[model samples]
Every structure is written in structure tokens, then in C-alpha cells.
Target: MAQDESLRDLYDGCYRRLVAQLYAICGNLGEAEDAVQEAFVRAVEKPRRFAQVDNPEAWLRTVALNVVRRRFRRLTRYRGLLRTAAASTPADAVPGLSPDHVTLVAALRQLPLEQREAITLHHIVDLPVREVALQLGVPEGTVKARLARGRARLAPLVREFAEDVEEVDHV
Candidate 1:
């Protein structure tokens, strides 16, 4: 009964202030309120633990902040997926990307899957050869060989494409 009263007192005393602080951090009144409410629900779910906290308000604030951060991260990932799915072509997928980047992507598609993966991870994704090998579950030497072959195949294709672009520009 005392624990329940303490929790009730904490809620009545801190709810509005916590929501205001969260609103300032999140810039959305609804989200801030929801996060603070969720924190209180969590506290109710663990009354004994909540009672043990030295600063219940700070604990609730941290929980609310974590909730906000998690939602932000999830929303960011969702938006990235939406952007990727909305574009039909690679060039259309990322605006402001250079022509060379588009050309590189097209050239990458022409390589065999293994070589393409190796080159993309090592050069484009900027992972080291060892890291690429680990990700691909292959030997470092294999990744190196794939990168070498991929680069060999791409050089001619890229050079020819660049020459064509240069001629067009000149005309």
C-alpha cells in the first residue's frame, strides 16, 4: 500500500515536468507524452525495483529518452528502406550522386556475384580485404583474387564509358 502511494505521489509530482523535458528533447508533444507514460508503465510493472532507485525521476527520464532514441533509430531505418524501394533505377535511388558512381554501379552489376561482392565490400563499402573475406566467409586470398579480377573487368568497361561521355561533352 505504501509502495503504491509512493508511486502515485511520484507520478503526480513528476509527470508533467518529465513530459515537458521530454517534449523539449523530442520536439513532439504526443511522442514525449507517450514515452513518459511508457516509462511510468514500466515503473508500475516493477514496483520493487522502482522503489529502490535513488532518483526515480531521473530513472524515468532516462527510460523516456531511451524510448525516444530507439523510435528515432527505427524511423530512420524505415525511411531509408522506403527511399531505396521508391527508386526504380540505381541512379534514381540516390540523387546528387555523380555519373561516375552510376557508372561504377552499372559496371559492378556486370561482374560475377563473388567478384561483385568482394569489390563492393572492399572498395565501395570501404571494408578491408580481411573484413570482406570474413563477411563473405571466404579466405583473404580469395577476396583479393576476386577484387583483382573485378577491377580488371571493370577497367575496360569504365574506360569505354568515360570515353563516350567525353566525346558527347566535346560535341
Candidate 2:
């Protein structure tokens, strides 16, 4: 009971902030929330392990990020299945996605995995180049190169979205 109360206090303190960070990482609030919740679940299940951690927030962040990564990998496999099974175009907005957001996500998906991950971490998640490099287990130079190439590729794809937004605004 004492452990549970302490864990509950930790959750209340961390949940919203973690959700924001994970949202930036994953670009989906629901996925971010789910991943954060899963991380808390793990912490609760292993109170001894959680208690011994030097930095609970760091542990939670790492666990949540890992959950997001694993989910992304699994979703990539299902994406191919969806492409084959669903006649609809991939850009069909999910329940909460604005058309522009859906279009942008679809564009991002066309990138190679490394480039996508690099760009998303550096740009979307707002991590610095060095941090991205560290997280990706690559040299800083490689991260910079990926960012350059990803930006070059994303420019044209995202340009259409910008145009659409402008047209909508004028109309």
C-alpha cells in the first residue's frame, strides 16, 4: 500500500509532462499517452526496481520512448497490410488528424527508416543533433547528413501541404 501510494504520487507528478514529451516524440497524443501509461505500469509492477532507480523521470522517459519505438516497428508491419487491404489512400485522415496533418504524416512515412527517425527526432521532437546521434547510436556527422537529406526530401512533400493551407486560408 505504501509503495502504491508513492507510485501514484509519482504518476500524478509525471504524467502530463511525460505525455507532452512523448507526444513530441511520436506525434500522436493517444500513442504518447498509452506509452506513458505502459511505462508507469511497469514501474508499479516492479516496485523494488523502481525504488532503486537513481532517476525515476529518466527511467520513465526511456521506458516510454522504448514503448513508442516498439509500437512504431509493429505498426510499420501493419501498414503494409493496411495498404494491401484498404482501398482508401493512405492519407485518409485518422479520426483526429486534420487533412494537412494526415498528408504530412503520409509524406514522412515515405522516408527511409533511418532518415525518418533522424528527422523526426531532430526536428519533430526538437532534440539537438548530438542528442539525436546519441539516441540513434550513430556519429554526429551521420545524424547531420540524415537531417540534410530528410529535409531535402521533406521540403517538396510538405510544400504541397503548405500550398493547400494557403488555398484554404484564402478561400
TM accuracy, model 2 = 0.64
lDDT of 1 by residue, 1-171 (tens): 998898899999989877755543444557768999999999999988988898787688768767877886786588798875332244325445466666676666566656765676567546699876766678999999999998999899899888999999999
**Candidate with best lDDT:** 2
List the candidate 1 regions with Cα displacement exceeding 4 Å: 84-171
Q: Rate the local accuracy (lDDT) of all candidates.
A: 0.74, 0.77
Write candidate 2's Cα lDDT for 24-103 as tens digits: 45656778799999999899889899999987876887788789889888877898877764333444634665676566
lDDT of 2 at 161: 76
> How do all models score by TM-score?
0.49, 0.64
Query: Which residue pairs in candidate 2 collide?
Result: none
- lDDT of candidate model 2 versus the reference: 0.77
State how far residue 61 of model 1 sits from its true place (Å). 0.3
